[model samples]
Target: MVHLVKSATVPEYASITGVSLGLKDKVVLGPFEVQFIDVDMYWSRLSFHVNGPDGPKLYVVGQGESFVYPAADNQYLNITLTWIRSDTKTALIEIQSPLQKLLSGQKLNVGDTINLPEGFPQISIKLTSTSDTQATFLVTLPYGETQTLVITEGSGGSVRYKLGDVYSYSNYVYIHLLNTTSDGPATVDIYVPKVASTDFKIVREGEEETAPTTTVETVLVYNDLLYVNEKLPITVDNVTYYVKLVSTIPDVAKVEVFKDDKSLGSIILRVNDDEPKNVPNAPIKLSVQSVEPEYKRAIIRVYGPAGAHVIPILRPANLLVKIDASPKEMLLGDELVVVINVENLGRGDAYDVSVAAPIPNDFELISMTKTWSLKTFPAFTNMPALIYVLKPTKVGEFEIGKAVVTFYDDTSIETNEEKTIYSPVLTGIKVYGIPKIEVNGMAYNGTWGNYVTATLATQSASSSPLKLPMGTRTMNSSRMPRSSSACPAASMAQLRLMLEP
Candidate 1:
C-alpha cells in the first residue's frame, strides 16, 4: 500500500449556519459570541461585537467580508457577514471554529448533505431516509469507515467498529434525532469531539505512529515574563535550546531561536492563540502570549520536545557607581570638579538608570549637571562620565555625599520598582584659606638725591590695621633707616628706606 504525505493545516472542526441577529442580538458558537450592532448604510459597513476566549473586541466589516479571530483551545474562528437586511434590521452571519460544538436545531431533508469543515479527519453526514417515527443517517469518517444508523425520535446513535471481538466506539461523530417525518425531513443535533494538541497521531499503513519520538510527550512547557534581549534556556532530549526576546514592538514580539550557543534564526509573532509553529527542523514550538511595549517586555510560552526541562535562571543587573573628585584638598572659594561613572557588572541589562550627585551644604554648585540618566546599559558596559563643578565656601574638611544610582532589570520590570545603589562616600576633602594683603607706594625725585617714599601698614584678618608713630627720616648711601609696627595678632610689617648716590 502507498502512503499519502500531506502537510498539517489548521483544522476547522465545526461550522454554524443560519445565524440571524438583530441590533444587540448575539449568538454563541463554541467559545465565540457575535452580537450585531448598528450598521452604516452609506459605507455599507456593519459593526459586530465579538467576545471569545481571548477577549471582547469590536469589529467592523463590510458585507461579504470575513474576519478571523482567536478562539478557545488555541483555535481560530472565521466569521463572515453573509447578508444584511436593512428593512428588517437583521443580519445573517456564518461562524466557523476549529473546535467542536453542538450543532442544534438543524432541519435536514432526505438526500441532504452536511459536510465537515476543511481540516484533518475530513467527514460528512447525509440523511438517506426518514420514516414517521425514525430517521436514517449515512456517516462517513476519516478512518475510511462508512456506517449506517437508524434511530427513532428523541434518540441518538454512535459509530463503532469491532476490534478483537469487542465493539470499539469511534467518537468521531454523533447524531441525535430530535423529530422526524415520513414525508422525508428530520430535525437533529450533531456533535464532534475536539482535537487536543497532542490528541492526533500520524497514521501510516493503517498503523498509528507518533509525531517524532521526541514529541510523543510534552518535554517542557515554559510560560513567563521575558525582557528584551533576555534569554530563556530550555533543555529537550538532553540538548539545551534557547529563546531570546529580541524586541517587543506593539503587538509583535521578535524572538531569536538558538541551539546551545549557535543561533538558528529569528521569528516575529503577533500575540494570539493561533497554533504554535515549530522552527524549521527543530522540535521547538514558540507562542507569544502578549507584548508590553511600554516596558520592552513580552509574555511567551515555549513547548519543547521529549525530555524537555527548564532551568530557572535569574538575571539581575549589578550596577556600580564610582565618584571621583580631583585634588581632594583645595583652598576655600576654589572650584572642584567631580566625575560620576556607572558600570553594569551583572549578567543582565539595565534600563532607565538615574544617577544623582548630592552637593554638600558647604560647597556651592558653580556649574554642573547634578543628575544623569542612561536609557540602556548592557552587561559589562560602562556609561560615559558625568561631570560637575563645585566651589568650597568654608575652610574645613568635609565628606562628599555618595552618588545615588537607581535602575531596573528584567525581573524588576514587572514590579515597576527600581533597584537603588550608591557610590562609596568620599572623605578627607580639605579646604584651606589663603591670606590676603594690600600694598601701596609712590616715588618722586628731590634736588640733592633721588628721594623714595612709601607707607606701610599692618592689618589683621578680622581686625583693623594698627599704625605705629610716623618718623620722617632721610638716608644716604652711608647709612640706612628702618621702622617696624605690629598688629594685635603679633604679625609685623617692616619698612627700610635707602638713598642711592
Candidate 2:
C-alpha cells in the first residue's frame, strides 16, 4: 500500500493509503491462522514550486536531471518542494538571469548567454585575478557584440565594475575586491600609474569617509618635480575603489644620490625652459648635450622615500689681488721689491692659481720668473708673497701697473677667472754730484810790510794748503770768508794788526 503525506500547496499534512483485504462471510471466528504481507516502496518524482514572473509555477525533476528557473534582477524567490513517495532523493537546481547565471560549482566564459526574463538586456562579463592565486573579476562594456572574461580559482577573488559612456568627457572607474578566503581578511594593493606624489588625494567612493593614508615613494626627481609610486592597504574585500580627484632627453641637469656621504647613483634628465623632466633611476648615463652657460642658475634635487636634499649650482671661486712696492722714494739706480697678494673671496676653493706681475720699461726684473704659481688658494685667505726684485733705471716718478691673478675652480678645468690689482708708484728719485771752489786774497801785515798776499784754492789734482806773508802776524778771526772771491772787513782789520806787530 502507498500513501501521500502532504500536497504541494497545502500547509497541512494528511495521508492516503491503498490496501487489499480477503473475507468469505461474516463469521465470528476465534484465533485462527493469520498472515501479514510485506511491500517495497520508493519515491517516483521530485516536484519544485517556484515563484515566476506571472505567478507560482511547478517543475518536476527526476534523478540526474536539472531544473532552471527564471528570476528578475535583484529579486528573491520563495521555493517549495514535494516528494511523490517517502524515499529520499536529490536534484540539480539553478537560478539564471538575462545578464548573469548562478550555478553550483561551474565556470562560464565568453559567448555564453544568461537566459534572463523578458524585457532585459544581456550584460557582458569579464574577469581577472591576481595575488595569492586569487582572482579579480571585471564586468566591462561589450566589445564588438562579444564579451571576454577570465575567472581564476584561488583562496580569494575581487571584482571591479566601471560605468560611463565610451566617449563621455567625464568618466568614472569602479573597483571591487572580494575575499573568498576563510582567513580573517585579505590584504590587497592598488596601483595607479603615471601620477605624481603631490597631485592626488585618496578618498572613499560614494561615502563621507576618508580613505587610508597612502605612502608615496619617490622613484625619481627631475627639475624639482617628483615622480612617485604609491602604496595603499585594502583592508576589506568586495569594496569599490575610486579616485577622490586631483591626480629627459637633454641632460640639462645631473643628479647624484648620496646617503651618509656615500654616493648611491647618478642620473641625467632633460631640461625644458629651465625645468627638468622624465628622469629615471640610478646608474643612468646623462647626456652631455651642451655645457651650461657660466653663471647660469641650475638645481639638483635628490630624494628618496624619507626626505630630499637640494644642491644649488653657482660660481665657485672669486679672486681679489693686490700688488705693493716697498721704499717709495729711492735713487735712480736703486732696486725695488714688489709683493703680490692673491686672496680668494668666494665660498668655494680656488685651484691652479697663477699671478703675473707687470714689468715696466723703467724697471729691470731681477727675479727669475715674472709669473707665480700656486696649487691652491683657500677661501678668505691670502697666498704666500709673490716677490719680484726690480731695479729702477729712470729718475722720474711713475705709477706701477697692475698684476693679474688667473685661477680656476675645482669643478672643471675649462673654467677660469682673473683679477687685477695696481701697486703705488715710485716717486722722488733724485741724482747728486760733488762741487769745486777756489779763492785768492791780499792781506796786510803790521811792521814788515803794509799788505800781504794770501791765496786759497781747492786743488783738483792733489791736496794743497793756502800760503800767506811770513813777516805779518798770523791773521786769526772767528768769522770766515763767505767765498774765495770776497774778503770780509773784519779779516782785513786782523790782517792790518798782524802787519803792525
Candidate 3:
C-alpha cells in the first residue's frame, strides 16, 4: 500500500494491487483481454517497466472474487500479441500494482519519481546489504503478480538484486573473511581447528541478526587481525607481552590454522584442569625449546606452552601350548600316553607353574611325569616349558579347562627395575586312542590285485623338503620312474610338472 506523504489530508492510495486494493469498480473477469506472455523463451523471468494507465490502476483478480467483463472503457488496456496463461497455473510474468512500483528503500507508487544511486547502472535493479555487499537472493517473489525494487546503500561497491512484492527465502550464500580492523597492525592469529562446510555468508550487522553462524548447511572460516590495544600475547625472554587487533571476514567464520608450510597441529584441548592424563607417560619425554622471531610462525612452539606426550597401555596376556601323545586318537580299552605343555605369558618370570589333565572314567593312569627336558627325551626338541605326561585306558573327550598354573612376580613398581621378558604360550594338546582308522570302500581286483598297506599322515610344522612315500614294487608296476612311483601333493611347482607336455 502506498500512502502519499505529501499531506495527511491526502487520502491513502490503496496499492493499485489486485490483492490489496479494490478492483470491483473498473475491472471484472469477463476476459475482454487475455493475459499475454511476450518474448518469454527469449527472455525468461525478465521484468518490463510498462507505463501504467494514467488514471486509476487495473487490478488482477484473486480467490473468491466474482467475474464479469471489465466495466465500460478499456481500463485493462494492453491487448497485444502476448503470452499469459490466466486462471490455470502460477503467473511467471508479473504485473505489479502502481504503489510498490516506486519504492526506492523509502516509499513509492506507479508514476512516482525514484532517484537511482550515483554510478549504479540505471538499466539494472539491485539491492545492497548492511555492509554494502552483493546479494545472492535466489528466491521466488510472492504477492502482487511480481515486484522489483532497487535496494541501495548511499554510494559504494554493489551487485545486481531484483525486488520482491513480498520477501521470502532464496538460495544459499557464501562468505569470505579478510583481516581489516583498527585493532590490527600486528599479526593476529586465528584458529579454525574444525568446521562443517564452507559456504557461510557475511550479513551486514544492520539486519540478519538471526541468521545461522555455524551450521551443516553452511561453512565458515575465521579472519582474525591484530591492530592496537588488543591483548595478543607473545612470549620473549621467558616473559609474556600483549598486543591489540581486530579481524573480519565479509561473512562470519571460524578459522582453522596451519603454520609455516605444514600442519603444526590443533591447539591442545583440555576438558578440565583436574583430569588425570596419561599422555605424559613416565617412560616418554617431550620438551619445547625457546624460539626466535624468525620462526614466529612455527607450529612446534618452544616456551611456557610446551607440552608432553603420554602413552596409554592396558594389561595384556598372550598364551599358547602344544601337547604330544602316544597312540593318538585312542580306541576303546586301548592304553594311551599323553603329554601336556604350558607357558608363562608375563613380562616377568612366574613361580609354581604346573600341568593338568582330565581323568577319563574308563582310563587308568599307570605312570606320570611333570618334569621333562632334553635329558628325558634326548632325541626330540626341548622347549623347556612346563610339561606333563600320563597313560590312560579309556575313551571320551578329556578336557583340562580348569587347570590353573599359579605364579608371583613384581606386578607393580615405584622405582627402577630390570625389564624381564617371558615367552607367552599357546596352550595346545595331543590325545591318544588306538585302532581308530576305519576300513571301507573295498573293491575286488583293484590295481595290482594284491594286498598292501598304506600309511597316511599329516606332516610336521617344520618345513622339511617333501619326500615321496617308499613302497615295494608290485609285479605289474615294477618299472615306473621314481617321479611316477609315488608323488607328493601337487603343490605350485608340482602342478607345473604335471601340466608339461
Number of clashing pairs per prediction, in order = 0, 13, 48
Q: Which regions of candidate 3 are displaced past 4 Å?
A: 1-326, 370-402, 412-501
Q: What lDDT is obtained when candidate 1 is compared to the true structure?
A: 0.66
| lDDT (Cα, tens digit) per residue for candidate 2, span 399-475 | 66778766777555445444333334433433211223333444332332433334322232222122233343443
Question: 439 in model 1: Cα distance from truth in Å?
Answer: 5.7
lDDT of each: 0.66, 0.35, 0.25
Summarize candidate 3's per-residue lDDT along 165-278 as a digit string, tens digits.
232111111111122222221111111101111122222314443332322211111112222222333333344332222222222111122222332222231211121111
User: What TM-score does candidate 1 get on C-alpha atoms?
Assistant: 0.34
For model 1, the stretches where C-alpha displacement exceeds 4 angstroms are 1-282, 285-313, 438-501
TM-score of model 3 vs. true structure = 0.18
Comparison by TM-score, 2 against 3, better one: 2
Q: Which ten residues in a row have the lowest lDDT in candidate 2?
A: 24-33
The Cα RMSD in angstroms, rounded to one decimal, for candidate 2 relative to the true structure is 34.3
Name the best candidate (by lDDT): 1
